[model samples]
Target: MSTVAPRFRSHAEDILDALRENPDREALVHGHRRVTAGEFHDLVHRTAWAMQGQGIERGQTVTLLSGNLPEAIAVRYAAHLIGAQVNHLYTGLSADVQAAIVHDVETRALVVDPRLADRAAAIVEAVPVKSVLALGPSATADDLLALAATRTTDPFPGQAGPDDICAIRHTGGTTGHPKGICTTYRQVREQRKAGRAGAIETDAARQLVATTIAHAAGMLADGVLESGGTVVMLDDFDPADVLTTVERERITHLWLLPPLLYQLLDHPAMGHTDTSTLRQVLYGGCQSSPARIADAVRRLGPVLVQGYGQNEGGLISVLTPADHDPDDPERLRTAGRILDGVEVEIRDEDGSALPDGEHGEICVRSAMVMQGYWKQPELTASVLRNGWLRTGDIGFRDAEGYLTVVDRLKDMIVVVGGHVYTTELEDLLNSHPDVRQCAVFGVRDEDGMERVHAAVLLAPGATTDSDELRALVRAERGAMYVPARITFPDELPLTDVGKPDKKELRRRATTPTT
Candidate 1:
């Protein structure tokens, strides 16, 4: 094994340093399997050596298609050690979409889970990557685990610089094809530092990672490992299973989306589960219903922390546990104060900054912000203006500096007399007892004027009158804010990342039926 002291500059290097410091500490816990920090470090090094032997080079892209497995984690770090850009494909995405992303990134190799062998095969058929390495046994590809076992567990001599592209994360792509948000090693390290500084630290935080580690949950796992804590991974999220794991593992932190959080709240196990060990329950990815958040605060204690960010802007703001006030209902509606080291401004269409309480595009400039979209220089230039990212989100900041995101700029409905925000109406509708989930969007009427339209998912075994919902919206917002049509769908179409697909909803609204 190579014994040269590891240089600690990038986030990946820092993680290696943490592993070296706590060699015997448990780094990961998945089901009955456990890997110590030392073991994980060795695995990563071996994987990196194997990848190098396979001709993977610096600045090349390696696409990972796997769930929350130890091998997946090791491969990601190995790529980082070898200066390869890691692009994680969402497991739930269609094979066609996955192939498109792979081709777009021009991935040199694909590291896939054994379970997703068929999907990987299909993707490879479409994209034709240079190498296909499976986590375990595979009929058509080399076994990454077996290859690592035969290789020397020596850290790769190569290391990525601060400005080198470390990752290419795919955005939700709610409107169209997913865009790859390019992030560098320096930005990732800065983001990690900011997250650690802003977090409420606990000794040896036992983090329950029930979501995909490919995204923000993976970042949270890094934070846990950095703090000498154990990461308990779940292949898939089952609300009851999550509750059981929390109690069994004594989980201290959890990162979930609003929908998953809601399921956890509604789970019967939630009532019996011992979640007192939880310090922070971070949620984001979509606008959360205030009612659901308030309920979470009441049931889950004051542990709910909301993160408002995008693929382009990494965690621009966070609503801390202290900010989840039940008494201050309006404050709960805010996305929380701007994150440390992040600058946020609500700007008008003319590129001028708007005053407090005036709604406009939420612009951000931060170290955590992505370098730009990969292979889309023109699109990147359009959004990135003089170091500020034009976040297409429409929101306003209160005098106290708390941000209230209304809706996406494109999702805003302009009526003849006034304007309507989709989230504003959706939030009110979600508060209804019978409504399980809802989405609001605008469709052009006969006169070419935008009219509000809604789709709702009712609670199981529950029924609701559309007129009642309309009256509630009219009373809470105004008569003009009421939806022109309300359709009760079996379930709202969800994007690959699990957010409600408003673009699809708009298509359904406009399409003619027999």
Candidate 2:
């Protein structure tokens, strides 16, 4: 960890100091407007004071529903200053799912972006939240900006301890209902410190944040601001907008999931845009196609950096820009070496450690790991055993210490005869030139036997026979690995966090057609 002076009380303090240091520097940019560091700090202070006035106390939860707006960042820092646990609702989730998370966290106050006021109102009705603050005009909630204007722009008197719960980030809910991961101020600080030591550039990083600030993009934005960098926020992701923003802002750092990266590559504007200023293009959240990643490196230069992490384990590993080499294709398959000061071990079902080259659960022990799941001791204990977070991902370490994630344990196809990993089949399907994207899973047949099934999205104006695709899989991995059914869908459903919605896919695959 980077040595910190005693004056820095918490992560919020560090940011406040950074903001003060560069008062005139651009802290956040959204559409046509930009907020300077000084202005942003004052906004955060007022927001914190307003929340305190609304009966929000330390340890209480403040749930926010917004995109990557300037107000969202302010509210997050405001919650941090007042020592309240902030829960960011995944905007893509259904109202019911978002309501469940609010109730699960026992949110004392709810904040909404004007665009999502209806969704927030639904959650407010479902949960017993005491207060509702909206970023803009709203019929059902108090206006946060209006309230901030009335409040003094002085720092909140209350300060959070290092061990205080800073944020309650929910899981992506790829498998089932999402669970809140308890993250502390100290954990976040340590992760930032470690990130700065490696991937985080020392020079001012002009970062383009096109994804939801509720997830990894938010974390990166925080780091950039703390290091005296600029955060360029986007309300929603558009391929053309991303390319244009990178060029317009001379964006040095950006983060995207593999799927979004593919879209940018396919977009006509991608080749025409000037992306020379981009120093790093961080990607994660799901497994990526090696062929697509290599293609990106060729087109966009060697700016691709793959980050492998979860809500529980902050950042386990990162495939650095130096590692993205066309000649060394095998390294691209790995999730990169274990992060500094993080211990990653592959363990069997019995909780015994497995040797290198053996596929098993990836367990992590690090300062960045979340404290535990919120208010779910049993569920927390199931994964957090002996201070090691048992990441449900099935992966193995190579002889060179690189981690290669095979598939999610629950998503593994279990046939009557043997098991089939979805990733293996997905990789094969993705290799086809005509295939834009694909998802593979196990579905029950008429005889109640689990069978391999696949849903694919073809490239624009491209066509391929399902039988030929199935035959390709059969020839590569034998009959057992071949999908029993292959359907060409316009597009596969995606989870709120942008991962392939395998749970939804299984439901669709098993549903009887008329």
Who wins the lDDT comparison?
1
Give the alpha carbon lDDT tens digit for every residue of 247-293 in model 2: 99999998888888888898898878999998888899888888788
C-alpha TM-score for every candidate: 0.94, 0.95
lDDT agreement with native, every candidate:
0.87, 0.86
| lDDT per residue as tens, model 1, 1-514 | 9999755466776677788798998989999999999999889889999999999998999999998898898899899988989999988788899999999999999999999999999999988999999999999999999999999976666578779999999976666888999999988888777776665453488888888887788888887887789999998888989999999999988888887888788777788889999988988988888888888999889898888888788877778889998777788889998877889999998989999999999999988889999999999999997889999999999998899999988888998788898888988998898887788899998889898899987888887879999999989998889999999988678665557788889989989998
Error of 2 at 94 (Å): 1.4
Candidate 1, run of 10 with poorest lDDT: 194-203
